[model samples]
Target: VITSENQLSFLNVTRSLEDLPVEQGNDAEGLLNECKEAMDHLYKADVYQSFDEPSLFIYRIDIRHNGSIHSQTGIVGLVPVEDTESVQILKHEEVRPERSDLMSRHLVAVGASSSPISLTYKNDEQLDKAITNCTSNEPVLMTEDSEMKQTIWKVVGETAKELSELVSNKILYITDGHHRMAAAEEALKKSNKNYGPLESTLAVLFPDDEMLVLPFHRRVGDPEGRSSQDLLKAISAVCEIEKSDETTPERIGEVGLYLDGQSHKIILPKSNGNNLVDQLDVARLQEHILAPIFGVVNPGTHKLIDYVPGPLGINVVKERCDKDSWLGFVMHPLKIKDLMDVAEAGELMPPKSSYLMPKPRSGVFVRDLNREKNIQ
Candidate 1:
């Protein structure tokens, strides 16, 4: 946690999340760390992470694809984060503590988050119409997601009345940013006399009908770690390999591994592997291929292998691998049902495997966890 015992005031900073300023040269992890540092540097941060009830946040993700307009549902409220034997909140992704610890340290010190974890709940048709009636008039923040237009509005007054009434039966589930939520839990645990077991951090809540899930594509560096032959051999045990004298994977369950222009499809065999996790595409690549042939255990955290969200499609992957003949894997996006099932079962998906969007850009919404007491 960033120790705000220094110059920044932890509370009452700025408004209009976009006006915060410009940033560059940062991957997802780097950008979040930068936000933590910014809060500590510019705002009065706290020495300890005090316990504040998790509050609902009115969020919006405006997407403009072609001529169509899709406005995402956003909510504001306190979420429960506790280490109870029976966990109330469910999560789809697993959190790495070290990563979370870094975020917690930053958050506790500066008391600000760069982004809201994107989460969706079981679909409630009734709730959908009410939320729409409230948000249709105006929006809080209207921005762009890649080429899609994005916008959001805070729910208050009459609008809030509808939200407050609807959320009574709401059971929030986190779809992404598992690490960030874990860090909040960690920070609360290490706080002063003010620590509370259940406090909601700012999150974007949407019903099952309104939720969108995207698959994340995987790429590996040159065949240096594993010779092309060894890699093919390992993949062959699980998949049906079709040697391509050409380039790229052309179909589903087909992955293209290229070493300096030599491309092949690392397709899995008809027979499925045992164990749910091992059966996954990412798992097969790691266990049979990456570890045995390439010697890389956690490709998720690997610097050489980059991940691209499926929505961006394969063009970006082609651009990244063109120079060195990098290996690119195309995956079918995970179904929403699978994501929720895993989360409810308390299992974490492979890191970087799921990319849920449209991502809620930080600075668009500012949540002062430190000032939660005065909110009422």
Candidate 2:
């Protein structure tokens, strides 16, 4: 529960050692010291291995879950943040200041980073052929986790240059990790003492067509204490309501709603064709139902709402309502093209509107900020 009584804490242990410093202390100096302590531990354990030359890594990930399979092949390398215009990176979501500050402090303290900011671009035949040729051999390293299997191959010299050139000018869309990218930029501005490797952060680039996107469902509560019937009547004003046997939302412009013990479907009234952001299902739910009916001015910070990733399934939404009297609204995944369109137009999506599948693992490829050279 993300309620006040059991809120998620920023001071808890993190998913990787690189983030341990931020969890250890309250002040920036304390956090830096803790970060140094964590890195000292990593070095003492002799886990800080360095490659001899700058290299490009070909990484393959296969994810199997709930009778479904998802996979992708991409290259992991350092992304230079100094030339934002040249990089042509696009972001659809806005970054919060607190999260960006946390990321900046951690990077300055740890003096290294391995978490790759995921990016996607249009497919290129030459790049695909290069990756295929390199991955045809046995991987240099392979590992299996609960969610996915990761295989990596190292490519250097002229071959690395060839692969890098193929994607040198393409516009890269941020599929995930907006805060981390913002933090990288913030780290560059605030920590002038350490901008060498901080000038760039590690990233993984995949073909957009091959990436998987899943819905981010919402758990809405009646904080004002309205009855289910009253709420249903209120919702009928802006949407066409129909009782649905299906739990998950099947397509765009439609949402799956779970209230009490029954499932229902809600379709948006025709698009007014104004404000692309308003046409989004999540935005419509907020503008029409959450704001107008439920009085939730800001769903991102409201106590009456919670976001559930699609991987957890709608059954979890049903379970939450059964346990706590909260209503659930499951949104269909937004199309990638729509996301790109919003980004290109300099518009932001509603918070937690996307749940990208098969998230890349951390600590797979470390970039040492202390080193002057790039990853090799």
Candidate 3:
């Protein structure tokens, strides 16, 4: 969509039409025209398909990485947007208001949700039994990509009802796509429509135990005129620094620092108190090291620091450090407990605190937000 206009240009048209530049024309008028064009193209291209009957399904994903295989199974359905305050849907991360607003506008323009908000819940045995019964036969839809294999089984009639009832009382945790959930809520509020599909969002629900979290690494650049030794001395004052044999972090509160062709391990202070959010290693790094020593109070927008997801591993951090950064910190990944605790306490995690493993592939399964019914 961001490339040449000659090939697969319809998506490009949609992107360009999305929230047009001020110099182009009026946003309201331009958006209406652009959406009309995009929707027409989408309908002709069969981008959105509808089912004759409303139904839920079992969505399964199996991913292989680094000689290991991880899998997640979930139910895909519509989650009520208004139930967030009722404790049915809980979010652990904070969303940027600007991003939320932009996505809200996108939802209004697109008119249908092409992606599902990923959600997690406490394990339910009844739900698992229902899924097992449904999967006894061949999958209704199965596909494979270069990285992962996906299998989906349609659950309709009484089976769907049973599965839905099994999970009706469970609380859902937001595993990914916090922004989309926020956008859905914003759209519902702004539209002044309290019922129907406008009041609900598409989501895929999985068990919390089956999900995986990977480390999110950070790279910090030395301040002007400061050397690698100066950075190390500053960090050493707060952490126990020692030469490390490996670049990967072994445990929580332990950070692997790569500087000037060498790697060192810094053991951070043990966290105390009942606040689980403050006890997080990322939080500790921010409180004791980044803000206090490196002057990066806001890591989310700080220019001196950069984040790399865990899939790229610690090597990327080292590579970046070798070029422009003075320090590369490889952190230990967070546990599911850590996430649940922080969420239960109504606290937010630090930026880039976690990278979910076996991420669900996009475009494999999509729900039409327009298919809303009385979802009591």
How far residue 324's Cα lies from its native spot in candidate 2, in Å, is: 1.2
Tens digits of lDDT, candidate 2, 40-59: 56556665456778899998
Better of 2 and 3 by lDDT: 2
Candidate 3 backbone clash number: 0
Each prediction's number of clashing residue pairs = 35, 0, 0
Error of 1 at 31 (Å): 13
Which wins on lDDT, candidate 1 or candidate 3?
Answer: 3
The alpha-carbon lDDT assigned to residue 200 of candidate 2 equals 82
Error of 2 at 38 (Å): 2.1
Give RMSD to native, each candidate: 7.3, 4.7, 3.2
lDDT of 3 by residue, 211-267 (tens): 888988998876654777887788788889999899788888788889898999989
Candidate 1: worst-modelled 10 consecutive residues by lDDT: 10-19
Clashing pairs in 3: none
Where is model 2 poorest over a 10-residue stretch in terms of lDDT? 1-10
lDDT, model 3 = 0.78
Q: Model 2, clash count? A: 0
TM-score of 1: 0.73
